[model samples]
Target: MVELNEVFETNTMIRDENLDVRTITMGIGLLDCCDSDVDILCDNIYKKITAVAKDLVKIGDEIGIDYGIPIINKRISVTPISLVGASSCRTRNDFVKIAETLERAACNVGVNFLGGYSALVQKGMSAADRLLIESIPYALANTEHICSSVSLASTKTGIDMDAVKLMGRVIKETAEATKDRDSIGCAKLVVFCNPADDNPFMAGAFHGVTETDTVINVGVSGPGVVKNAISKVKGQNFEVLCETVKKTAFKVTRVGQLVAKEASRRLNVPFGIVDLSLAPTPAIGDSIADIIQEMGVEYVGAPGTTAALAILNDQVKKGGVMASSYVGGLSGAFIPVSEDRSMAYAAEIGALSIDKLEAMTCVCSVGLDMIPIPGDTPAETISGIIADEMAIGMVNQKTTAVRLIPVIGKKAGETVEFGGLLGNSTIMPVNKYGCKDFIDRGGRIPAPIHSFKN
Candidate 1:
């Protein structure tokens, strides 16, 4: 038997300093729930969800208390509702039923968010895909805890111009539906380019068909740990800062492995993968931007920020892979503007803009997360941002996404306070300059010139 202490301890002084696994998500595959009869399909989904996750919340609570760290959320991800509902639903009302059933099931089982209310049309939109996108505003307006996403592009295939245009329209409609409430419905939606199937993160995670049936994936978060590590360094030597981040990441990943093993054991579910992302809340001291600032940058969007993040992301993957046998998902750093206090503060103070955020996304885990734009920004402009972000992932061959909320009636620098985990944000300005020519070009940029390296 391996000694756990020997495995966890090394030259690093940091060893599980108030660390915790943030989420234990049950990825219940609902592909088998596709029956011709809508009612039968609904029943099958409900039964499977309850049966697999009956003791999920209880097990999570026990493990959390035992480890003396709070498990922030218990969640579920199902098969993409588009594919699962396609067989049973012939109309818009049928899609509504699917969304409502998912919402009710999650509330009944005490799951915070039920993901997989999504569609993947990175190549082209199906009739079913069109209907799914059309119903999002209504489904999100009606349901309580259902999240939706649309993956419009992928490196494997290429950009889908038609789907991108459709998603831009869908985003506008979703925002219009929830305009009175800080566009909260838009808050639940994510637009992705190269989204991962096993992502345990919220509002963007869905059960991609490539995933196994009912696996358990963990998302570990601790920007506080990373910031503390950098705070000890009195002066700026970029290399030293990188080493500190690497050593700190090793300890953080070790804690994640222990918590994940414990959670898997108690839930009776096989452990899937650990997402070593430094996810943040609106709370002070928990921001990834704060970690960068502590490393000697004036603010997160400064000149060296992207380079700093590139080193941090690479070092994190290096340490996390050494600590865990299976490390997956967006296992880097996350810098959601509204969700991270320091990032939001930077936007508020005029240190970070959409241009700078674009550059940072190349180095960070996800792109332009939880950013608020003016409600009247042209639909074309929103699509343009998506195209630009997707192009970065396509050229670099990595996962990149966008979750921009066009907060209705809000303008640049205006704060919108969302009183909970949804967080708050000051609306960031989009480029007044148009990308009409580039966006209208409408053809796949033919994978990177470097992708032919083979």
Candidate 2:
């Protein structure tokens, strides 16, 4: 059943094409750690996370060494803290204490990041959820590894304009709280519509209350591999281009399958799913934009860009589904501006604007990711942006998210260096007109007519 040439081809993909497992995330539930006392709650969370994930980093490294796969990150996702700490977190500081405990657990477990500092308020926010949300700025400003998300909209529940307005202010406060580091704290926060639970990615990963207690989800990425495959057929017809992307995605996903099965067997955790997201990096050629360019777009925001991206997204999903036993977690192409070198360059040169990126998100995977606007951008404007993206996801019944940073002290055309996987972002100007009246009239935006199919 084994083939030598296939092995060699995978080796070449890893060595030359930038193929790698982006993350191996372990999702753990904290429901049993809930307590009525804040101190006891913090203690219970720390012990549970540390006990369950003590070997996460070690086993991940061992597996990478044994399989010759470059595992970029080993992380953890827990049940949303708002739910877990509801009885104990009476104030914002109480929630912040839980965040510090999570940061400590992350350090002790040696994880690259720890997610699920979150609250889900798609329909409405509870008292505890509000407290956790209020504490986000302080929590993120103080912690290094903690990542947070808020689910403010879903197709079934529509967009929560109340949460949207609050999140705009929360994002602004987060930027101000961590202004010394180019407002890096906001980079660790994401606002989502219909977010997936088994996502092995940061800033949006959370162990859904409905999910199993412990499971391992692996995220695989290979934009460079996809690009290299289709580049062989440059100027070819659509049929040829699509076939190349599908076959290339199949090969890349099989690597993820192998790693997932092996890691699950060794760790005694359930294999969740393989997320074949084709997430791009700062490295040259390892970019979704490059793949789009090879597919006939002059740049990512060109006239034909959305069509190219749609084709790529559909084909990648088709191929990945064929290769993996189970596939989930935003399994398509991600177009984060800050994380991809070519996309970021496109924004810098005015080839890509936030408006074009929003259009692309209508077809691509997630939305408005890693975009930096000027600090002077109003909270109402940010709320308007969130409302727009959430409306897209609500109407189309697809998952979309925003990870925007109002980098303090930076203006349009200026750059903030985030470094590492986050890369760098050039601030872009927002619309000059104010949307204060629109945001101030905050109430829940009702679900679409299609959502009445009960």
What C-alpha lDDT do the candidate models reach, one value each?
A: 0.83, 0.93
- Looking at model 1, which ten-residue stretch has the lowest summed lDDT? 9-18
lDDT of residue 224 for candidate 1: 81
lDDT of 2 by residue, 144-250 (tens): 99999999999999999999999999999999999999999999999999999889998899999888999999999999899999989998899999999999999
lDDT of 1: 0.83
Q: Write the per-residue lDDT of candidate 1 for residues 1-454, one digit (tens) a residue.
A: 6577745542222233335577888898898989999899888888888888888888888887776557788899988899998888888778888898898789778988989899998887778888888899999989878999888877777778777766777788889999888888888899887898999998888876888787888888777888888888859687788888888788788777877888888787888888998888887777788888887789999989998788878888887888887898889998888888889989999999999999999988889889989989887888899888988887778888888899889888789987677688889999898866666767555556665655
List where candidate 1 sits over 4 angstroms from the true fold.
1-18, 436-445, 449-454
Displacement of the residue 260 alpha carbon in candidate 2, Å = 0.9
Error (Å) of candidate 1 at residue 126 is: 1.6
TM-score of each: 0.94, 0.99
Q: By lDDT, who's the top model here?
A: 2
Q: Which ten residues in a row have the lowest lDDT in candidate 2?
A: 425-434
lDDT of 1 at 349: 92
